[model samples]
Target chain A: MNTLQLDLGERSYPIHIGANLLAQPDLYKKHLKGSLTAVVTNETVAPLYADRVVKTLESLGQKVKLIVLPDGEVFKTWEVLQKIFDGLLECSADRKATLVALGGGVIGDMTGFAAACYMRGIRFIQVPTTLLSQVDSSVGGKTGINHPLGKNMVGAFYQPQAVIADLDTLKTLPPKELAAGLAEVIKHGAIADAEFLTWIENNQNALNACDPKAMEHAVRRSCEIKSQVVAQDEKEGGLRAILNFGHTFGHAIEAGMGYGQWLHGEAVGCGMVLAADLSVRVGLLSEADASRLKKITAALRLPTVPPKLGINRYMELMSVDKKAEGGEVRYILLDGFGRAKIQAVDDALVIQTLQAAGAG
Target chain B: MNTLQLDLGERSYPIHIGANLLAQPDLYKKHLKGSLTAVVTNETVAPLYADRVVKTLESLGQKVKLIVLPDGEVFKTWEVLQKIFDGLLECSADRKATLVALGGGVIGDMTGFAAACYMRGIRFIQVPTTLLSQVDSSVGGKTGINHPLGKNMVGAFYQPQAVIADLDTLKTLPPKELAAGLAEVIKHGAIADAEFLTWIENNQNALNACDPKAMEHAVRRSCEIKSQVVAQDEKEGGLRAILNFGHTFGHAIEAGMGYGQWLHGEAVGCGMVLAADLSVRVGLLSEADASRLKKITAALRLPTVPPKLGINRYMELMSVDKKAEGGEVRYILLDGFGRAKIQAVDDALVIQTLQAAGAG
Candidate 1:
């Protein structure tokens, strides 16, 4: 077992990476505050892990309530959120109760948001099952539902008490989702750690094969990078914006292609390519390093070309991206291979990048 | 003008109590972060004050967008919140843009919650028009929408940059709503300030008449007491529960009678009577003090008798109160005339108090 801590003062919590972690009591039980615990999972994940999770909590004498939401990014809506509320209220779960999110990013985001809003706020644990979630979303306290007009448009920065990433669950994950998760791992390296990027390049075959040792290293390093960034800029005042390196363009792809059409990681994987292209055009990054980043994403079997949504459609969607200010979209471009900076690109330059990076 | 600051470290903000505050650009404009601002008001308040608010911000070179929601407590829902998001997205308002909630408690709460969730978080200002909001909701960072299953079941504790409470807006407030606002004032006095309680008792007629001087004193004093309590316990971990002296029972009243059927203040007024009765039964308060509290609420023309929601219904509703833990309903009752404590009363004892205080 390997552990990494996200130091957030009073809000600090640990992320545990290991196989069969859910079967281990100490990882989750240490964070449990009250006797009442609600396990919020989606339908797909519920059939697989809900029983083990409930059994573990019940063994610790917790009165457990299971709230199973429908699966998918589309289910991440206000109506589904209300269902979580309904379960909490129906079971009379109070402010003292703990909510355990027992699925991937969707469940983690929804449950973290549910905890933030449930009775103003409550304690919750993140048990991220997907690689994407374990590496990124679950670490930073960014939990919210997507607005129809945009992705992750509604949410809160409510941190969890702890994060339990049981690698055993990854065994059941579809290959496509696993590869999608690597997009974020690649992002962490691209934005902050050049050494980690080289390490990823060396271990690409090991990662593609889903070797436990390689997976553990990728997850831990990614979380360490994220935790350091979040500890400094908890609410994205300035430094935290760097973490959204590919997200602005990624969000446009997610919204433009219709949410759920492309997995978040896939969109982000392609978005990073465009951001790199824009970086080279703006003279912020070298053409060699930009292509290296693109080559690595392609090697991971992630999308290297963005879908050709009309430049105007993409512009309309990106205009509503949270990173935009006063209607001008701010792009997070690489200063080099491992450093990121937020800059406003010229409209003409962005259009050129769009034209150059689009799939035929 | 009277000002009180709720000291929450960096999240601290000032509460300005005066007449014609909206016309003063320095009060709000100084806190404005970006050139774009969205003024969120309800229908009832829009025709009355939206133009002045927009003009005030416009005077300071802010490009403003006005979003008018239907006026009423019932309109505080996710669907209406979508309207606020729609307006911001439609105009492409970004993270730096400001959201100014320009109505009573409902508008303040909905807009504050929207600002808290929009793009994960953004800067917002409170321009409270109703006396209820001026004294209570606007000062604290508590903002949310009511769920069908529970009131304030979904929300966040996102503080505003500043709160501008213009007493001048109360001149147009309906008589019934003004009295409802007084209920909170009376509560502040009863729970924390015996002297303020005595003052409310002596000045009932002036308060009932909506005298500007009396209104200013009541609003300022209430905010002072609330700000002090919130500064110590911002998230209600302990001492702050005392602030909800009548809210446990009050939430039941609001949920028992369909929301908006009984104005929040009216229900809280009557709930205080029931809570006082329970406190007397528990031997924490004197019968004489309890009756005195009831007499003042009655004197203000607020309800002294709670509607006859069956004991079972009240118990069912109160069990879901945020104060409750592990299915035990915790009531905030007066320990004497001005002190409060949270304790779990026996269900039978609560039933007895309900039978004694209900309208016959």
Candidate 2:
């Protein structure tokens, strides 16, 4: 087991990574300092692991409540958030109550957002059940639900007290979902760590097989990289946007296809390929390097071609994405595998990419 | 104009208190860095001040969008927030869009919450039209909506870029509403400043007459004191909880009777009176001090006693207030007129207060 601490002074917290960390009762009991606990999960993950989490928390004599939301990205709404509030209120959860987000990115984001708004704010933990959540969303403190109009439109930058990423939980995740998560890991490598990218290429199969050590290392490294970035720029004022290496196009794809049609990470994987292709077009990425990127993503069974469904839909959806600043489209472009910068790409580039996706 | 700054680093902004601050076109123009400006106001204030504000902002060559929400606390809900989002999308307002909260607490809170959620937040300025909003809710970054289950159950602590408290708007406010706002001013005196308390006592009647200079001093002093406290505890982590003086019981009075039935300040006025009496019982205040408090509140035409309502209803509403930490029911107890502290008061005290309200 390896652990990394996000040193944000008072808001600083620890992230634990191991295959069986879920069984370590102390991981939750020691860090969770409250009278009541609400473990928020989704319908999909609940049948598999909810009982294990509840039993562990209950053994510590912490009053626990379970709130099971619908299992998809589209279900993240104000109505669903109300169910979380109802669970807390019905259980008499107080301001000191600790919320545990016990599933993947959807569950974690909605639960953390609930904690942020429940009683105006409360303590919460991330018990992420998927690779994408463990590596990316859970640690950054960006919690929100999608507006029918846009994704992550309503939220707060509320940091969690701790993150418990149990790799054992990822054993049940389908290979397609697993491949989707690799998009973020590949993003980490593409934006800042060429060595990590090389390593991921070498160990791609090990991760797909859910090898405990390799999966744990990837989540830990991704968290370490993310924590360092967030500690410096908690609000995406700068540097942190690099974390959105594939997210600009990814959000457009997600919204254009409708939120749940394509899982966030699935869109991101295909979007990364498009962004890399675009980077090459702009003379920042080498064609050879882009091919290597495509080979690795394809090997993992992740999408590598630009999706054709959302070419015209891009303008409307991308307009409201968080990445858009000053009414202009800002893309996180790669200068190389380990260097990325936010750039205002011309409409010609965007149109060409959409055309490429349409023809593909 | 006397200005007070809530110095929250990047989130910090100025609170300008005086007559004609609204007419100063520079106030809106300075923060209008981006191309789009969306002004949110309620129906009541729009016909009077909307054109003037729009004129000023438009003269600066910024694209302007105006959204008028129904004017009342009942309208402060997700439904109204959706309307704001719809308006923003209809006008193609994007991330760089600046949201100007162009009304009182309801408009400001709903607008701020909308801004906080619109593209994960944008620049917002509080144009507080009433005394309650200008002196209190406007300064804090706390923005949210009432839930059927509870008041302010969903929200975000999003700070504004600036707070414009144009006292000129107070001239249009009703006498009863104006008196309701005085409760907050009296609260500022009760919790922190001894001399300010003395000043309010001496000139309470003059303030009732709408003396602009006295109103300026009151608003400026209240903000300065709140600014200092907020700087120390931005999230009600500790000292900031003291700002909720009378709010615990006050929230109950408002929510129990249904919000806006008793104005926020009116409920707080009565809540303060009860708190002072309870403070005497708790040995933190003298009988004379309690009596003096009641006399002053009554002189300002504020309620000295909560409405004779159902006791159980009050209890249920109070439990749902976001301030009840750990289910222990923390209360903001006044040590006297110029100092306050947060303490876990006995449930017996809360029950007694509810019983008293029922019998009043």
Candidate 3:
């Protein structure tokens, strides 16, 4: 098993990466706090792994409660987040109980947020079952539900006790979901690690085929970059804003497409392409580098062409994004091959990039 | 103007206590961040002081927006919390925008929780109008909405940039509300300040008459005791539990009687009496001291007798309280004149106390 630790002072936690790591009771036992544990998962992933987790916890004499929510990005709302609370309250889950988020990004985000607010905060563990969550959401303490006005507009930056990413769970991921996960993997490389970007470009076929070694490498590299960024700036005051490279435009895309229609990763994939296009138009990134970024996105079967959501609609949606400030949407654009920075671009130029990226 | 600072390390903020504090543009400007500010108040407070706050901000050259929610504790739900987000989104409030929570405890809590979760947290200032909020909720960083199952069950420990407690607003407060605020004032004395308890007893007539000098002293002292306790234990790990001296039973009363049926302070007033009875029964507190506490509560015109919600029902509701652990309801009982601690008492003793307190 490969392990990476996010050194966030008192909030520091570990990420365990390996196949069949879920069956390891020691990993689950070492991190959890208090007496009782609530494993929060979604319907799609619950039937697959919830029982296994419950059995493991119960076998260890840990009082375990389960809350299975409906799957899909659409379910990531305050109403759905309430279900986790209701379940915990019904089961008499106390201050000492730890919540184990046991699904993909949506589950991790919602469960992590629930932990953050439960009794003004409780211990939670991340059992991210998808590559998207394992590399991205699982590492950062950012957890929240989507608002109707924008995606992830309401949430908290609450860390987990630990993160366990069992590669075996990837076996059940559909091809579309796998490709969606690649969007975030591609983002980690595009924003900070050029060598990792090249590795992803070189191992496109293996990654697309879900090769174990390639997947492990990709997840590890992505987590290392995210953990470093988060450790330096946990609250996203400065440097952490760069991690949201494709998120500003991606959130617009997700909101415009009416959430769940376009996967978060898919929106981010297209968003990275548009941000790259904006970077090139603004003369920040070279056309060759921009094309290379788009090339990798396309190679992984992720959407490079953004849906033709009207430019006005896109601008309207993007303006409400978390990244937007004082009526200006700040775009995270690549300054060089592997470096990115937050910049507020001219509206006309942003519109031009939106038009061009949509037409691509 | 009287000022008490809550020294919570980096999260520390100042609580300004005085008459006409809302008119002070500098106090509002000094603490608020960003270019735009959204002032969140309620329908009741809107006509009273919302315009004055807006005028103050506008005169300071700060672009201001307003969102007026329905008043009362019943309105402190996820549905109402969403309206603040809707208003912020409609006006394009960003991460840089400051949310000025301008109302009572309900408004302070919901608005603070909104600011805490808005864009994964943002800067917020508390403009507390009610006595309960000005002395308690406004100072502490406890912000959140309520679930149907519980009060403050869903929330965050996000502190505000500053708190402005304008005593002039109390002029318009109903007599019942003023008495309710004394419950918390009484709690502060019971838990941490013996001299303050005597002061409250001596100044009951002045407090009931809403004497300005007496009110200021009460508010200031309550905040000082609370600030000291919170500074030592922000997350209620140990010392902070004493701050919730009457809250465990108070929350149960509030939940059992139906939210907003009786004021939070009213429930707590009776809850303190019940806790005292339990302390006496457990031999931790003398009957004379318990009766003295009850007499003070009675003299203040606050409820000393609790409604007879079935013992089983009370236990069920109290078990879900944030203070409860492993299905054991930990009661915060006063051990002596000015000391309180969390103790999980025998079920039979708890039931006996409930029966006697309800009968009283």
Candidate 4:
């Protein structure tokens, strides 16, 4: 078992990664403060792992309640998030009750948000089942439901008690979702570690085949890079903007295409391509490096071509993004192979790139 | 104007108490970080003060958007809170946008919670028009909407950039609302300042008449007491629970009667009476002191009798209160004239107190 700690002072928690860690009651016992525990998972994950987690908690004398939400990104909304609250309230879950989120990114995001708001704040644990969640969403405390206008438009920076990522869960991930998770894994390397990017390039087959050893490295390295960035700027005042390297364009594509049409990671994967192209146009990166990043993105079976959203619509979606300040959409561009920068570029230049990329 | 700083380290903010402070653009100017500002008020307050506030912000070069929600606590639900989000998104309000809560407690709470969740978090200033909000909700940063099951069941402890309490606004308040505000004033004196309690007892006529000087002192003193408690324990881990002095029983009355039937402070006023009775039963407070507190509550024209919601119903409602931990309802009892203690008492003893208070 490998454990990584996200250092957020009092809010800091551990990330446990290994095989069948869900069966280990000790990981949960250390964090839970109350006898009542609510396991919040979606329908897809509940049928698979809810029993294991419920039995483990019940064994420790916890009064367990299973709340199963519908599975999908489209289900991430205020109406659906309220179900978790209803379930908790119906059972008279108090401030001391603990919530264990057992699902992928959608479940983790909604559960973390519910924990942040339920009783004005309570303790929650993240048990991310999908590769995308294990590598990215589960590590950072960013949890919220999406508005119809934008993705992740309403949320909180609430950290979790701990994150348990069992590699065995990845054995069941669909190929598309696996590739979506790789988009974030690739992002960690593309923005922070050149050597890790090269390693990913060298081990394409190993990652594609879902090898345990390769999956472990990808999750660990991605978490290490993310935790370091988050520890410095938990609220994203400045330095943390680099972590949203492809998110500015990715959010635009996701919102423009209507969320759930393209997975977040898939949108981010293609977003990295556009961001790289913009970075080259703005004289921040060489054409060679841009192409290299694109090749690597495509190598992971992720989409590289931009969606067919027109420039005006794309610009409208990007302007409403949370990253935009004072109506100016800030683009996260690659400064080099392993570095990123946040700045606002001219509309003409952005549109030119969008047109060239077939997004116009 | 009198200014008191709530020392919350980096999250610290100033509370300004005086007449006509809301019309002063400089107060708003110093805290606003962006050009776009949203003034969130309710229908009752909009026609009265919305134009003045919008003109103030506009005078300071801010493009103000007015979001008017339905008045009353019954509207303090997720469905109503969504209107604020809709207004912000419609205008493309960004992370840097400032939200000015321009009404009483409900507006302050919903706007503050909206600011806390909008784009993960943003800045907001509290322009409390009601005395209850000016003295209590605006200072502590406890913001949230009510769940169907309970009042304030879901929310966040998000502080505002500044609290602007205009004493002049109190002149327009109805007689019933003025008395409701006095309940919190009396509570501030009872829990933290015996001298203030004595002063309130002696100056009932001035408070009841809405005298500017008396209201100023009451607002300023209450902010001082609440801010000091919040600074020590911002998240209600321990000492902060004492600040909820009468809230446990008060919430029960509010929920049992259905919200909006009794103004929050009115319910709190009556709750204090029952809590004092319980404190006397527990031997923590003298019967003489408890009677004195009840006399002061009644002198302000606030109700001292709790509605007859049988003991079982009261127990059921209080158990689901945000203050309850692991199904144990922790009651905040008066330790003496100027202090409070939090503990779980025997249910039978509590029932006796409720029965004596005409609540059973």
Error of 2 at A101 (Å): 0.4
Q: What does candidate 3's lDDT look like per residue over A219-245, in tens digits? A: 999899999999999998889999888
| CAPRI tier of model 3 | high
Model 2 off-target regions past 4 Å? B349-360
Off by over 4 Å in 3: none
lDDT of 4 by residue, A41-85 (tens): 988898899999999999999999999999999999999999999
Please identify which of the two predictions, 2 or 4, would achieve the higher lDDT against the true structure. Answer: 4
Candidate 4 RMSD computed on C-alpha atoms after optimal superposition onto the true structure: 1.1
Q: What is candidate 3's lDDT per residue for B1-360, written digit by digit as tens?
A: 988889999999898999989999889878766778899999999999999999999998888889999999999999999999999888888888899999899999999999999988889999999899987889889999898888988999989999999999998999899989999999999998889999999999999998999999999999999999999989878888888888878888899889999999998998899899999999999999999999999888898877778888888888888888777778898889798978899989988988876631
lDDT (tens digit, per residue) of candidate 1 on A325-357 = 766788999999789989899988888899887
lDDT of each: 0.90, 0.84, 0.89, 0.92
Candidates arranged by lDDT, highest first: 4, 1, 3, 2
Instruction: Select the stronger candidate by TM-score from 1 and 4.
Output: 4
> Clash totals for all models, in order?
0, 0, 0, 0
Can you rank all candidates by DockQ, best first?
Answer: 4, 1, 3, 2
Kindly list the per-residue Cα lDDT of model 4 for residues B1-360, writing each as its tens digit.
Answer: 999999999899989999888789989998989899999999999999999999999999999999989999999999999899999999999888999999999999999999999999999999999999989988888999999899998999999999999999999999889888888888888888999998998899999999888898999999999999999999999999887888889999999999999999999999899999999999999999999989989889999999999999998888888888877888999889888889999898789988998888
Candidate 2 colliding pairs: none
Identify the leading candidate in terms of lDDT.
Answer: 4
